[model samples]
Target: MTGACRRARELVSDACARWHLPELVAPASVVLTELVGNVVRHAGTPMQVTLTLRRPYLQVAVTDGSRRDIRPVPAPDVRAEGGRGLLLVRELARRWGIAPLGDGKVVWALLPAA
Candidate 1:
């Protein structure tokens, strides 16, 4: 999981640099990490991370081999140690959602890149 987050962050950082949207590197990395973390904790399946430049937004998504529904908790129990990752992602990203695919689902977040 750590390695996956590392590589995914590197990919997001590299993409931001290539696109000259350096300001997005940090938040984008965090959002990507949370998205990846969700898969590691719940899906436990091979995942695909994608970073897409959509003009003013950077679309970060993780496609996992689990078809289960993934939803963010508005306000997780304060005493709980886990389950706040998606909440963090929701707070950081401008917009985020999940899409069901044939064999799995794609969780994505759109962060302001401009």
Candidate 2:
């Protein structure tokens, strides 16, 4: 999981640099880490992370090995130190959702390219 997060950051950083869009790296990196970490924790397997460039958006997808219902844990007490990952993604991403895959699912997010 940690390695996945690290690799995700590396890939995002490379994309940002190659695209000459350095400003998008931080939030994208955090979201990627959270999404990939969820895959490792809940899906019980390493996941695949991919990034795609589009006219006005960047698409990030993380495919996990479980089709378990993955939903955001809403309204945790502020003092609690975890479970806010998906909530953060919901708030930060322009758009996001989960799609069923064979024996698994892929969670995806779209962020503004502008």
Question: What overall lDDT goes with each candidate model?
Answer: 0.91, 0.86
Summing lDDT over every window of 10 consecutive residues in candidate 1, give the lowest-scoring window: 69-78
Model 1 over residues 6-112: C-alpha lDDT tens digits?
A: 99999998999999998999999999999898899899999999999997899999999999897647789889888788888989999999999999999999998
Displacement of residue 81 (Cα, Å) in model 1 is 1.5
How high is the lDDT of residue 92 in model 2? 72
Q: Give the distance in Å from residue 106's predicted Cα in candidate 1 to where it truly belongs.
A: 0.4
Error of 1 at 79 (Å): 1.8
In candidate 2 the C-alpha lDDT for residue 1 amounts to 70
RMSD of each: 1.0, 1.2
How does residue 17 of candidate 1 score in lDDT?
Answer: 90
**Best by TM-score, which number?**
1
Clashing pairs in 2: none
Model 1 per-residue lDDT at 37: 88
